[model samples]
Target chain A: MNSQNVFMGENLQELTVHGKKEFPIQYYADELFRLPGCQFPLHWHTEIEFFAARGGSIKAQIGRLEFLLEEGDGVFVNSNVLHSFSQLRPEDRCRCPNVVFSGELIAPADHLIYQKYIGPLLSSRQLPCVILKPSIPWQNSILSCLDRLFSLMQKHALKEERRPLPLLSFDSPADDIPCWEMQVQNELNRIWQLLISHAGEIPPVNIEKGEASLQIRMQKMLAFIRSHYASPVSLDEIAASASISKSEASRCFQAYMNQPPVSYLLDFRLEKAKQLLSSTPDTVEEISRKCGFRSSGYFCRIFKRRTGASPNQYRRETT
Target chain B: MNSQNVFMGENLQELTVHGKKEFPIQYYADELFRLPGCQFPLHWHTEIEFFAARGGSIKAQIGRLEFLLEEGDGVFVNSNVLHSFSQLRPEDRCRCPNVVFSGELIAPADHLIYQKYIGPLLSSRQLPCVILKPSIPWQNSILSCLDRLFSLMQKHALKEERRPLPLLSFDSPADDIPCWEMQVQNELNRIWQLLISHAGEIPPVNIEKGEASLQIRMQKMLAFIRSHYASPVSLDEIAASASISKSEASRCFQAYMNQPPVSYLLDFRLEKAKQLLSSTPDTVEEISRKCGFRSSGYFCRIFKRRTGASPNQYRRETT
Candidate 1:
């Protein structure tokens, strides 16, 4: 009944069903300007996501690859892919109109549209995300459909103007639902048609059998770091969480993330510290310790090196 | 050697080869503002075309279907599809950055990308043209690639800035050819990837055996009408051109074009008359007779009804 922000924490995004147990589509149009650091923390969802950049350049990280999308650009993140977004420029706010929907919206398991097109794309390991830029013909066609859908959904939301925006919860339609729902479905199907046609062209990255397992291991390590970032964590401890040797963990992180486990851990802590510095009224020393920094002096040094501002200065400026 | 506009006449465009035998690709970037009525007449090319609307709304007709593309909108006209471009609003001159490249540019017939992706698309009877609106995600991506290619090609072309403009004849060897040609090829391949991914989604319009034959008949009728529209033509004479009965020809026209055979002929004649009126110094009587109208009075009445202008008025306004 109400628009709920699905907190995507891990790899498998458990989509929140609205009315029925089987319904699997969720639409969220959120302004990243309102979020801390204007970013969504790295997470993956089971539902495919269509993220359109309304304004400013948005940086999107899908799996291990990252893309900088300018205004009017969009990216389609395939299901169960690790992805996140941040404003390219910190000062400029970005709004992403997103549609996270299950593949079932277009076709059932037996349908030709699904078996022929949607199945291959959702199952592709190589195509983690497709960046939609306005200059390319097919990509532009998909974006056009998305823009229309976003505008229609936005208009409908504005008309209701409820306290908590109504989650697109398509199954339980209120009596006063806007007539544009059919248009939204049509546009989505059009996008699916485009996706299916070009799905094969996305060269399948020869993901060796070991690569998937390694990705899962790296994912586990990431989850561990996320859960225990506030505690003093070591490379060995992170490796132990995934039942791998420290060197293997280091190698896995380097292979997938282009960073060592320790560096990723430190960066995660710094991000958490930055969030705390802006959101909480805690003193710099307390915040540093809370974010797993050994000392406020060391945290300040790393924070400035990463964010171009000291803890006090960042807090002051943001506040 | 020199920038040449490949005069696309009728349906099967026998591409004009320049400087070499069997040149596979021909590229032209032409501004329609300087041309009379700011439009390119109905024609089709064997090579695929990526037309990006630079400014204003451009109206494109592919086969019997028409689409209005706004600035920043692009359309991909599939190989050998009868298509034409015109300024949607005659007063507003539209600049189209066009790339007419053969399928060979991306992959040879024996190559996997061509065999798997390009071959099916070029040979598909169902897909005539794909209109790339900037709002669609995948299409937007292709358009983005095209825009970059156009800019790069434009920059390269500008360096020479010679009279008659140079055709993007890729076979010739120049010191700087490799640099920009590689960029062009890269961008085109990028476009192909987006295209091949989405091409399958365009459902094969179940085209029954009867329907496919009818389409071929209709295409032949169209070609015949195009060649013979200038002279006094009758429904029987047009029908004979495609070796079909008069009633069958009428039925085919109604089915495919949604108009009667005579009505289509009259409309085609009127279009010719309009072109002659604006482009030449011919009198209304002379142009009407040349375009197959029985009388100037009848031509004036039909022209006014279709275009909301008398022959002299239309000429004055356009000129």
Candidate 2:
């Protein structure tokens, strides 16, 4: 990926679409311990997402809100909200299976059902994220539907990404895929209505001016780092791109992303180096210098420590 | 139900809504032999409908088309199509479970999903009704969804006529209801997409100017009968209402409705008497007079023979 173009030239908003436009959803069975640094980086997209913690506890940080979601518990993160999840303890060995989807999967924006029930809930200043638990009845219903939804996706949805699920047509000749599209839709509808019914009790997220602007500033800084990750990136330059002081940029990252600005820069650099190693036949020293690392030895140490594999080992396994 | 009003007098359109407007759908587990005269008269409504025959064979007459649908066989009637079901043979005991719903129940008219997919199919001149048999794979998929939908409705929907199924609300406090709304919607969506995929294989019903006019003339004649059934309607007047000869009118009725005009009037009269018997304090003679039967004794005989109950016995049992 070209660093400047792939970063969208400081467009700031995350450009990764969760699923295909026709039937927009991506079902994930994520093992947290398997991910880099035992956590995926904080990112925000236009699509909404739901994460159900499984096997062990995990801490979900959405915007400025942070909470522990245990097994049998889940969380709903609203659209355009920056969020991340990580193990509660370093060795938690958690699994957090989830789905990320555009709202259009359930109802188009012009639909009456969307206008009456869905629009208000989505645009409300109060609900950036809602934590779900089995103790509550309505929340339990939502979680139960999520469970059923995951199972439905696992059963019928092909492992291939971005293709339309073989829901109805005999064209693809996958007989195991029954009429799953509609069944999954039915579960989603129930979950949405459950959220509607509890709109009042869920506290407002306080995405007032201060928090919203902080998120914008954070995005600009991240965009700057992404565009410049192939070269040396400093906190001073990142802060200058967002027109904020270096300390303010650090505060913005900490507030919305639950990490410091330098830590993010390091992660981005390491991520870019891994991409180069996997996609290109470049030497280790060449990749390390191109990814803004001080030395190939330091790069290899950090890569092995974070990913539990040497660069050559990763390339061999993946290639 | 008033005779003139219940008949929707000269409107020619059936006015009985299958379900509520907000969430429109009505489910029926119809035992064919229990229905008067072993059939319902030809009726046309704007909403679409689906029926799966169980236990024995029954013939479906849709517009000018007629076919036998056996157990594990189903049919889909498009919007505004006139259709009816009857025992293939009088002794063939059968149960035809079905759902009647407006197109809006599946997708709002303005949605892209509706405009791109659902609208074309419902308004297709080629597909008045589709027969589904378990022998074909795609057809069997649709039939399986119908089976699943019926079972979902049976489990989650209250026995009440028009109430919204207990889809998500805890307000009504029925503990057994789960998230069934989306599951049923999923099945319906798959069924719709299957029809779309098989659009080429399905033959158009030849609803050309000739056939369309035949249906219109038939409707006008039925409307005439609906308006005048309680006042001793004659075949001649029925023919004159739509400016056709008596024989042409009989042919039109048989061609579209699968029965003669006099039989329609007779069944309609019996239907009116049954309503009056159940809803009014009138004596059997009074109902017979109101429904334009020749005499109370003649009315009683016809009612007992058609419905397996005398007028007085039906009234007493119902009241």
Candidate 3:
């Protein structure tokens, strides 16, 4: 938080531009919104950050490049890179649970296991950044470890802050906390034990059954539109496939799929047309026919309006 | 590319995997496919992978979860995460240019600079997994470094792979070809130069201007649909804001955006209704009105069709 140290142990605390937190480990979880949206602006400090967006989208700009992030995706930004986040839409926004403990907060480098794996990976890449999407089988273990790390940090925080408390025993002062580091180490052991336990068994199915049903419907709809969109197909036709009425189809389409029947059909057609345009090097007229567009001029207008570039321009730029 | 040990030396003289190449150093750039429509199976390896989706949509399933990746979005799947990828649409698939080199491939760990930063972060967190989205300013640099790494890898591959007929030198028998390790080292130097030069600058903008325009339009369209879908918003209303004609708008909606106008609007409305139905303890009729559905019967039908479970069931399960 200060010039000498942007992040200091709360007991040996210092505060700065990132705002203030009195906790032992300044938890970034509750305060992530301060950065807002998904992208983070140019900024760097000595604190190590753990970022995970379980749902939604995130984009970060570090220098000139921008990196798009999706749910269950995250990256480790070494203290060296200046970075910032851009806000995302309400629908697109996601909650990324993370904790930031100063790099200097834990035991020295020699004691950590991450050094064996993460250490070499980071060093070999020569990249100031490391991005990660923990696989499902690894998610629980990873999250559990992080959760423990947070608790450990919290435990230490209490000791550092020396919060006043009444003692049960008549021995020693009530203000003193029992061995905090040992507790944290125990937490780390529990996390490791959980990870070892869940090493390879198939990951748990977390999406609800109803959500699964909706997902199935979405796939069916997508397949149907991809196959029959070019030819005339009505809402009723698609609905019949899902064994539902036209109106019912409309509601399902909106909630989980993000588009209704007719709209999805159009998307299928347009996407097909774009494929022809980008890969085949075909003319607008030719692509229109292949994509089920009736008129060449109409197709060109559509391509331009949607893509902000003519078919020809898109091909040229890409090729 | 070998498992046990990767040997890098002069191009010609190589045999055993672990056997060191005679020359000082050797660099090889393996050509990664740039297929826009190809899909890779779920897999993992010991080496670190840098994945970048240049265009369209790519969904990767690692562990138990699925991630929908767009352009410029990437995930670092550490070793042991079982993963697979699929192209949502033939045209929606794109190539990712990545550099794969071993920790032993570059400098020894002791001399690496990045090790200094990552060591502290990992040891401090004691986390089993960490995901990060770099802030702006840092993104560009990381991207540029990756870009340079890939470029150098390619150039090195060429030098190692191609050898012009050796000039007739009056030295020993023609079998003696001087080691190309020096050449590879030189190439690595060139890569380092590029990285150093661009280290202070923003990384390359991976998304094309045209692509950004389309994305911006998509963002606006999404906002419009979210805001006005409740009432009745025509195709004209959506297209007008994006500055396109109705038919053209349809194409835009279909293409990159992945849905048609009315259908998307309807879908959005229905989804809102579903959320309300599940979250709020409201009458079905009230929920229907809140979600823009006309009648309870219609809402029920749509909900049932989209979700095999009725609204009530969904609410119960969710609650």
Candidate 4:
């Protein structure tokens, strides 16, 4: 929320831990109507995510596969998968809850329990995401678990302001639950037992590894450009981050971000220049240098072109 | 289940990882009437355990705090705490479900979420165990979570023999949950949120650190004697494991196991010999050396005295 843009890391990782180190999971509910494009852009995190469109319809894409998540329907994304969510009708309401968690919370990586059961699904190259419809039985059972899990999140989120939950410590009698810790673990293990037992039966997504990795490298190129924008970031440096030729890097930027490398860099620099003008007391020359422009005159011309106002005028009006 | 004895480790730790390293939780149901003397002897585990008596009343002691766990009631034992459970009446059936888990499952130890909310209750020397009855509201909520959790365990345990669970990956959709991974983590976090909110009101147990450490030392001593039984483990070594005098060590063995240290060691060696006699082709002299009985004559005399049969006769009958 703090960053104005969706910032992927240089290695194309989301870099957020997702949840606590112990039980890697986190909950989120978003209204797409408020977002810049009524969608979260293409980004990949190592943690698997469950995205549900709770209100109206939404468009989702995992790798090259694109589909609409009908209201009340959800999708299960695999780890290291590139995915995005958007409102089908951004003019109206489109709300969603994204639940992200690591597979490790179900089982450890080293154990045979994990390898024999959980690992196959995560590392399956043939599958990237699964669409869950309520009409199906086994999928419905999975949805039911998720319903309880997320509904609890909604309820807790609502009550969090007023409630100080009961701790397990009991010197005298308090009204807290006695053994919830046991129940959560038990439920999760059982849920895993249900999922892995029928993994082979589910149809494959047929998504290619190369296509996914291409988006990943594209993201790395974007991240490299974003981070080094204040310095004189080059086409060579951007290409090297994703390990591609310079022309291939330009082609990636044009394909994914709809701009050539230099244009995107200029847009990024202009955005930063505007931010600095409003937030800092630096002079025009200092701000230009800080934003990676070789000359203040060039910076002023680009700033006027992008915003129809000089940096100082834009800052003055905004402030 | 594989080992015939309750094996603690040399560091006074129970080395079992409990559940998968990712989750660190496991479930067990025991019938105390089936156990020796209708009781599980005193042992300290680093993981926290929830001991609930489902069928009959049972005696439970966490650290110095000893009490009865009435039928339909449960107790929460903190980590690294010494605790024991036994039937209040050995003649009748006593069934219990013991849910053991690491605190990491709630939140990682290093996080502020864990330190501020969960850690205080765990590291508090004044608290060891909390008793939970059905009458208290908050405590009942805690028990409800446990009930649901354990009920799922019992249900899954039953279905596990027959049902194959659905995997999340769906190409043709034979039916699996789309987002169960999200739910499990969501549920666990919500459960933690509820637990920590009411911690301050729970009464302290007043169990001293010195007393808990004594049980800890006693356990290390027992583990030392058990692991080194095949060698010439002396009283000095046993005493040193617990950092106590030889007389004090002897007293602990007598108090806890209801025997002197040497007597317990002899019984253990004989048990090992009996197992080897039936399982292996080792001669009496080799068995004697392995059991640390000093000589075949002494080993034979002790074996006969305890089992009322010669080593060969016992081996013949058992085999």
DockQ of 2: 0.08
Q: Evaluated against the true chain A, what TM-score does chain A of model 3 have?
A: 0.40
TM-score of predicted chain B versus true chain B for each candidate: 0.66, 0.82, 0.40, 0.76
lDDT of 3 at A311: 80
Model 1 lDDT, residue A224, Cα:
81
- lDDT by residue for model 3 over B1-319, one digit each (tens)? 2211111111211122321322222222211232212445323333334555454666665443466766555444433233445565664424455433332222223422224322222222122121212344444344444454444434443345562311211111211212222222223333333333333352332333354355345545655665565566778888887777888778766654346877766766665666676668998788877666767898899889876888888888877
Runs in model 4 with CA error above 4 Å?
A1-210, A227-254, A258-266, A284-306, B1-3, B7-39, B50-57, B61-66, B69-77, B83-124, B130-209, B227-255, B258-270, B273-319
* Residues forming the 10-long window of minimal summed lDDT in candidate 1 chain A: A1-10
Once fitted onto the true fold, the runs of candidate 3 whose alpha carbons sit more than 4 angstroms away are A1-319, B1-209
Q: B139-180 in candidate 2: lDDT tens per residue?
A: 988887887777766555545445433232111232243335
* TM-score (C-alpha) between model 2 and the true structure: 0.59
List, residue by residue over A1-319, the lDDT tens digit for candidate 3. 1111221112111233331221123434322333323334233444555555544666655323456756556555544343444445555534454554433222223422234322332332134444445565455455555555554444444345463321111111222223333333333334333333443343332333454355445445544655565566788888887676788788877754346878756655666676666668677777777767768788788778877888888878767
Residue A146 displacement in candidate 2 (angstroms): 1.3
**lDDT, candidate 4, B177-266, per-residue tens:** 443333333334554544555566677666544675667677788688667887998889989988899998887776566688888788
Expressed as tens digits, the lDDT of each residue in A82-120 for candidate 2 is 777887776776666678876666766654455656666
DockQ for each numbered candidate: 0.01, 0.08, 0.01, 0.12
Which candidate should be chosen as best, given lDDT against the real structure?
2
Interface RMSD (Å), each candidate? 18.0, 5.4, 20.2, 8.3
lDDT of 1: 0.68
Candidate 1 residue lDDT tens string, A134-193:
888889889888877666555554454442442332212333322344344446767876
